[model samples]
Target chain A: GGIITQTPKFLIGQEGQKLTLKCQQNFNHDTMYWYRQDSGKGLRLIYYSITENDLQKGDLSEGYDASREKKSSFSLTVTSAQKNEMAVFLCASSIPFSNERLFFGHGTKLSVL
Target chain B: GDSVTQTEGLVTLTKGLPVMLNCTYQTTYSPFLFWYVQHLNEAPKLLLKSSTDNKRTEHQGFYATLHKSSSSFHLQKSSVQLSDSALYFCALRNMLSGSFNKLTFGAGTRLAVCP
Candidate 1:
């Protein structure tokens, strides 16, 4: 079985700072997604890529940017960190050929001071 | 807009007790429903899913039925275990898209199973 890896298990940033999170998957899946999770809240999709170099925005993509530069990797950037922001960023991949069951990364916990 | 709603924020149960977590949703398209479990400090994992109306789907002793008429996919288990304690999320996938299936999730319910 393949694994999904996310860099920087914990992140701390200052207000207005720009930060980035990276994800890599060995599953060789065709689709990748980025989601944000606030404490006690459900995940909100920020962006997703169906293929390399493709990007699609989700409802919560306004403050974020995503890149699918290669098939195995997808990255997300917080355009400008907001003060007192705290959330977890999760990355997932799936193969749509079967019913899509997403495999997720452990998540990056972000704390913006 | 497609969305999911989970009724309780926290549910505490004893081992071997019956369990149920209410999940309801709203969507304009035929929806594919799913239940995910997240252990502390771990990523959420798929627990159960249902695309066929009124059919029950199960995994790891947990089960749920997707009721299209009521827009509900309530999770249930006859016997709860300590391992079952975790955060549970209900999600929906928009089925109208040809290839891309976008998902929307509900605010999670925290399940605590004690001995």
Candidate 2:
């Protein structure tokens, strides 16, 4: 059994500030993903990596950057935070196949002032 | 482009009552449908998934049948409990796309089960 850990369960940032969130998974899964969840909205894919050093953009990649330096770690960066912005960022990992179930982290709640 | 739709934004029910949440989808290719439940402050967990048509799949007392003719996969439970309160999301996987990992999700339905 493995767990996906997301750092800084709660995040607060100022407008125009840059913030970074980190994720680590011990599942050794081949694929990792970042998703953003807003109130009343479904989770939107930000970025995903098929393997270490690989990056793929999703529907909501704009204003966000991701890194997959190692298979166990995937990180996301918000280039410029918007004032009063609030959302939860989730990290997930899955086996090599697409049909495989995804394991998710608790998520990082972000609030920008 | 593929999309999923969950009609109810909020559903309030009493304990012991039957539970049902509507879901519909649109896609050009064969679809894999999934139901995910997220408790307060918890990560969303897969409740059920099915790719076969007219076959019922169930998990944790919840069940859903994939109706290709109606393009629906509605989640239901025989009886509700307070513990059943959570946000439910319906998602679709586009098998035709090269990146099958990509999933399109519905807006989500929030269920509040009271005693």
TM-score of chain A of each: 0.96, 0.98
Off by more than 4 A, model 1? none
Q: Pick the candidate with the highest TM-score.
A: 2
Rate residue B83 of model 2 by lDDT. Answer: 96
Please list, in the order the candidates appear, how each scores on TM-score for chain B only.
Answer: 0.95, 0.98
lDDT of 2 by residue, A61-109 (tens): 9999999999999999999999999999999999865787888999999
Cα lDDT of model 2 by residue, B1-115, tens digit: 8888898999999999999999999999999999999999898889999999999999999999999999999999999999999999999987875768788889999999988
Point to the candidate with the largest DockQ. 2
Q: How would you encode candidate 1's per-residue C-alpha lDDT over B1-115 as one tens digit per residue? A: 8889998999999999999999999988888888999999888999998899988888889999899999999999999999999999999886776534578899999999999
Separate DockQ for every predicted complex: 0.70, 0.72
Error at B32, model 1, angstroms:
0.6
lDDT for model 1 comes to 0.91
Best by lDDT: 2
